[model samples]
Target chain A: MSWQLTEQDLPDLARGAAVLGTGGGGDPYVGQLLARQAIREHGPITVLDPDELDDDTLVIPTAQMGAPTVVHEKLPRGSEPVDALRALEKHLGRAADATMPIECGGINSMIPLVVAARTRLPVVDADGMGRAFPELQMETFGVYGVPGSPMAIAGERGETTVIDTGADNKHMEWLARGVTVRLGGVAHIAEYAMTGAQVKRTAVPRTLTLALTIGRAIRQARERNADPIAALAEALSHTLYAHLRVLFRGKISDVERRTEAGFARGRATAQSFDGQHELELRFQNENLVALVDGTVRCVVPDLVCVLESEQAEPITTETLRYGQRVTVVGISTPALMRTPEALAVFGPAAFGLPYTFTPVEEAAVGTTA
Target chain B: MSWQLTEQDLPDLARGAAVLGTGGGGDPYVGQLLARQAIREHGPITVLDPDELDDDTLVIPTAQMGAPTVVHEKLPRGSEPVDALRALEKHLGRAADATMPIECGGINSMIPLVVAARTRLPVVDADGMGRAFPELQMETFGVYGVPGSPMAIAGERGETTVIDTGADNKHMEWLARGVTVRLGGVAHIAEYAMTGAQVKRTAVPRTLTLALTIGRAIRQARERNADPIAALAEALSHTLYAHLRVLFRGKISDVERRTEAGFARGRATAQSFDGQHELELRFQNENLVALVDGTVRCVVPDLVCVLESEQAEPITTETLRYGQRVTVVGISTPALMRTPEALAVFGPAAFGLPYTFTPVEEAAVGTTA
Candidate 1:
């Protein structure tokens, strides 16, 4: 499908991306503003399905890396995303034909849109990760044998670095992370550049439209005075994200947060409204696990989203504060994420959790409207 | 003066460089061996006076970054220096017609020679710093006018990173240091690239021949069974390094070491052979300061050299050990480094020393022979 993203779509895209961000892509406010401003200035953006691109067309993924605490306060100069793309293009001595998101969650998802709007380049419908993960190498692109560089990391502070190394994808993540830290713990990186056919073969397909639909569903539910949670389940169920369930419903009783190694990390404890049960959430940028009363209720590769209990507004992990009323939703990740190979890189073990992963669908039933 | 460096020059060059290294720049043994091997295979290297170059010719400086312990143990793949130069060339889209040293001290001084041997590009007689100062921004080039990047840093693991930023020279050093740490605590950096005219105006003139001459003086002193310490002071007094003195003479009694921020850091205490006095030496990569019973003696912007008491071999801080007899010599820094402005950056205050700087010559009487 080919689509044009006008300013009107910004709210829904940011909302859905926040939900998909599963608490780690960082706050979408800045990303949303940047995208809106760019679109308003440069006209609507043409978003293309990966297949719409010719085999030789070049596509690059754009992302902002840093602790959410830092990115939230130190807004980008807005030129960063495009600057990173141009740097990558210069490094290649070839121009990128389109832009794509490295992940479908948080601020990262919106970055590509901003670049596409400003450059009037087509934006790819797919992303490297169907949902957000904490680090660069956790994407399906790496698990499937694609190298991350020639990647470019450009900072708002007039620093542009290009790395073409024989290092493995994980090492590439470390190298990029180090550079981000030096650039005031925030930088725009355009990496994992691939040809259009490689994008089709490796990227998680159509997450952009899925995010828009998910955003629209919850908004429509609020308008109709229906259950937003049920609307969320149906919205996810209709897409490749085929399983959804509310893993916990509670009021946040306690929360701990620490910004470390360019990540917003901590645990959140939500107490049951009935005072009989509690949910414990562990996160490193994104929520990795949810345990209810010492029982493992959800684990990755599965999407764990925290939403305000009544408003159903997506509460990213960075925004999780004490005394908030919330419901945690679990959606089975895209099939590409559940493969044994992909699981090896992003499963519970990869996050240093004790238990192995279990599909959210297998762990719960009757989760749809 | 234009000259060709035969393989026989490697020993004296390494010897003088180690002395100038002033207990930093790591062991030149490996660098010397590498240069010897390259010269044997690629034949003689042309060494050029900065004035000999056409005004538009490109000149790049090459050096290794990181702790001596790690570099000595891991060793480079031998291609890193050339690889870094080539990467810089590719980044600039202009081939380098000549190469130079960022610092004419320790292992860094030997890098340009090795590169020159391999590429047959003339090695410039001038260097960024007449002596090493442990950081990149401390170069004379940046203080005068030229920007550091279009600088390229290449790793032995086949990684080449180019950093192009409008950041100040100090920030460039920090950024490059950060990258070096990620590339396994050691990397080859080709930075402060400039045109031949810029090199002639900013570089410390004839520092290469100075290193070789100094090396030959100490070696000849040992061969003649004369006082090597006196010979060293005489050799330095005869050149632009117009002042020299023995700051302390003793046997190593105690040493402390720790690796921090990818730099070998520690203090060594040398107790006088007669047992009345002791000198405390502190270093980060190279010797930064020396104190006699808590009184400041030699601070940065001046050269501090540690030599084996018997053989006159330059004992770099990395190889400092208990029970070795040694003489600590101090030489007035090049006139460029002693300026109030330059000292403000590489001075005693810059390195966190408590007192104002006093030139070794001004502080010691009858210092020159």
Candidate 2:
């Protein structure tokens, strides 16, 4: 299906984008504004599925690679992503046939639209990461063998760096970060070289559909004054099992932050169930694991979202703070993240959890359903 | 040259290990203890250069991949590396020709010896990182195209995982961390598929020689009652011109810490030079960069070292705290790390700095000798 960005798609896209963020994609507001501005200037963007492309179609998954917190204060200058894509195209000696999101979460989700609108390329309806992560390589696309280097990183100063370091995605992220910080903490980067066939092989097919449905669910919940959790559950009828639990309900009592390797590393302690329990959340870039009463209940690759009970809106780990009431929800990772290879990459232990292979259903079994 | 470990190697090894740690390789005490014990039990390890290897030889870089803090308390059962290597060999359906350290900093420097003594394989007198970094993939070897995954990750509990998510190096780090945490925050890992050609091409040639010399200089300094800085400067003659810089002479005032993505991330503000100067250090699995007076004085791939004047010993960022008189020194990165390609991966920008390369020499020409 062709995924065009109509005015109607904007709201759903923003809402869905936030959910797919996995509690780490930067504020969707900035990205939303950027996308809106671009759409208004250039009209709706066109999105295409991998199947719609020619065999040699040059598909690049573009993103922002540094501290998410930096992105809020250091807003994009409108031309960075477009410039990055052009730089990448120049490096490749061929124009991009399509553009895709590296992730469908945070600012990254909306970035593809901005790039696509400016570049006049169709935005792919899929992403590298099924959710957001802290680094460049933590995505479904990378797991499926998409390269992150040979990447074109563009700054607002009209400078572009085509990073092609072999196997060191962190270094690339590190280098990109310098430019981002130089550009006042936000640099537009376009990366991941793939042919249409390669994109079809690696990407989570139809993620745009999922994004739309999830976004629609959140919006519908708000419009009808319905329980958003139930709406979300209903939306994922086939993907999620019937039995899901609200693992803990509490207010954040403490948050500790430390920036390591330029990525935020921290933990938040939540006093929940009317002070009867405490849930601790650990993060590096993205929230990787959640510990309830000293036992790991949710781990990376799965979605560990902290939502406000009243509005059901996601609260990013960076935004989490003391005295904010939140409901911890754990959703099982998609099939792509559950494969032996994916689990080996992002499973519970990957985030330093002691347990392995316990589905959210099992991990949250004892919690209130 | 055939290298043999001895009681004399420990002190020097510790000193050199800290220098190689690049500021965040974690406490070397435990690694030294483990290596010393292993040496006492299994005999001194023999280190061989990669050039001596046969073209068909199998070389595995083995080390602990997890939080250094957790490693101190969760201590290994002495078989984690051996187990990880054995599992690796099993997966490869062959025996390893040799083993080597991924980094020469902290525990990683000694781990090669532990594995060598246990497996009866020679430890290569080279490493991936001349200095230590905080994650699995932020190494020169990784930049040289060493794969960090399809790794053999093992725990003392007999648990083993052969991770093969075909992502870049950082993803492997995340995956390894997940296992480390699953195993209670530490795991022995054997990763990176290296051909003999790669071993010879990328392994920091004769790093053990450099480590030994640095160690010897420290020992000599203590014995002769000479200045350790002078001794170290003399020891690092090859790279000293660019690497050595006295960046700060201050006492630590505040230290903030929080864990993210299985790493300790934080900054230690040091009060030095009769003024309040903050040396901001960021670490993942190792220290990646250092900022002095809000400007990046040194970035990754270069040596960012914090030392205590009392003994001229290197201090891990985790242990850095208030009341500690620290002399922040910047060691110029090797020529290999300064290449545009390398800079694209490990420069100031790579560490999330907003500045471009202005060698430590240029930045602190007057502040340092």
Candidate 3:
């Protein structure tokens, strides 16, 4: 089914996308403002189902690439993504049938919405990553053999660069990262142009609709004076992420963070009220691994999300401050993302974590109970 | 006014280009090999006079960009410049009628010739900078109102990037420099796409012919046992760079050099035979300022060249070694390039030097004597 994503849906979409962000993809609030302003000016955007498109349809995924910490301070001019889209279109000499999120997380999820609203192109209700990972090549589209170029990157003042390289996706990321750093640590990019059939085969379908459902659940729970964390878990119970575990409920004790090489790299530590239980989360943009009291409870290819203890509002890596009350949650990733081939691209070892790939269900069993 | 540039002209062209390089623009020997091989494979290239071009003729300038030190080790595959040219042509939907050197210095002077040979485009007998400077914006085309983009850059492995920015030329250099570093410290670029009228208005005219004359003068001087340095000055006396002075004749005492931020930057000191006079040459790829006994003898937008004291062969910055006997020369730049408008872009202060713009003639007066 198709749907119209109006101004009313932005708040819920942002909240839900942030949850899926798993502590990366930049702050959703900033992206929400850009998307809302674009929607108000250009009218609502249409969200198309991945299955509804013909195989020949061209789909371009658009996102923000840079440190989340920097994106917070250097607000985009709100036209960079559209500029990138137009540049790519000009280079290809063909208009994109639709735009989609490269990753369904925080700002990236909203970026495609902003581009779609401005360009009057429908956004597909799917994404390359159902839950965000840090690097470009970690996406299913890349892992499944789709090239990330010819990619277009745009800066705030209308400076645009189009890269068409014979290099692999990793090299593309390296090249684009260098450009992003030169563009003041942030850039809007449109890449991984794919046909509809490729999208259907490689993308995490229904993630956009899934985000809206999760957002609605959290909102409804908060309205009824119920537990939002429980609502969030319940929302995931019927979806692809069927296993949800609250890894730790506590206040942030410490955060050692720095913006280096165009990424927000750091670790955050959360301690229980009694200080007996501790959880350490390591990240490079998105949370890669979670260790609970020296035991590897959750690792990448799975979600390690931190949300406010009460309201269940998600906390981005950039916003993980000391003394903040939070509930760390671990959710199982979709089956498609957990396959051997998929894990090879984004699994625990891919992030230099020493642990092997373990399902969130198996990893969280005794501890959550 | 036009001529055929065969493999036979390469040695002379390279030698003259090295003189004009003013101690930068990569090693001419490497470029000579590439151009010679290209000419051998693709036949002789036609050198076109700027005045003969139709007003609407598209003339693209090509050059090698990176620290000259790196280019010595990472020889290009001889195809990057043509790749960049083709990519730019594809982007603009127009074929280039001719190719020209962005600078008439060292490897860059030979780059366009190589492109012209491979692509069958005529080589323009002109250049943006008659003498090389380190940065991209220090060119007559940029100083006199031509934009440096839409520019195309190509790496050795066929990776191509096209930049179209609303930012000024300096920012474009910054953006492109970052890409160059990621492309392994060297890239072939085609930029400053100008019409024949613009080329005629802004580019330094007849520089290709001037370089060949300089080379011939040195070769004949060496063969006749005449003073090569005197021959070099005589060669320049008939050209735009008419004022020439041998600033210092000495053995190199010390060199403080390092590659940083994608540039080979350093200072070299030379002491006269009697050890009574010392000259310090400050360079960032190309010699920028020369101080004889702590007094400014010559600064940029003028030519500050270093050559073997005996042979008069140009010595690039990377090749400047301790104990080498050398003669430093200063020559006046073309009057067009010495204008206040041009000075604002490539003058002393533009390079963050404390001195003001003084014609090399006036600055060198009484110093050499």
> TM-scores of all models?
0.94, 0.52, 0.98
True-vs-predicted CA distance for residue B135, candidate 1, Å: 0.5
What's each prediction's clash count? 2, 25, 0
Task: Judge the docking of candidate 2 as incorrect, acceptable, medium or high.
Answer: incorrect
Point out the higher-scoring one by TM-score: 2 or 3.
3
Q: Name the regions of candidate 1 deviating beyond 4 angstroms.
A: A365-369, B271-278, B293-296, B366-369
Cα RMSD over interface residues, candidate 1: 1.1
Candidate 2 chain A — worst ten consecutive residues by lDDT sum? Answer: A237-246
For model 2, the stretches where C-alpha displacement exceeds 4 angstroms are: A1-369, B239-242, B276-278
Q: Alpha-carbon error at A249 in model 2, in Å?
A: 28
Per-residue lDDT of model 2, residues B272-340, tens digit only: 656756666666556666677767776666777888876678888777777988887877756665677
Query: Which residue pairs in model 1 clash with each other?
Result: A23-A317, B23-B317
Residues A1-369 of candidate 1: C-alpha lDDT, one tens digit per residue: 798888898888899999998887888878999988898899999999887889899888888988888888889877897899999999889988889998999998789988998888899999888898989889888878778888889887767988887537777788888989999989998899888888888889998998898889999999999998898888887799987888888889998999888888899998888888888999998998888887777788798889998978989777788899998888888888899999998999988899978888776553221
DockQ of each: 0.80, 0.02, 0.87
Off by over 4 Å in 3: none
Which of candidates 2 and 3 reaches a greater lDDT?
3
Each candidate: what lDDT?
0.85, 0.74, 0.91
Q: Estimate the TM-score for candidate 3.
A: 0.98
Model 1 CAPRI quality: medium
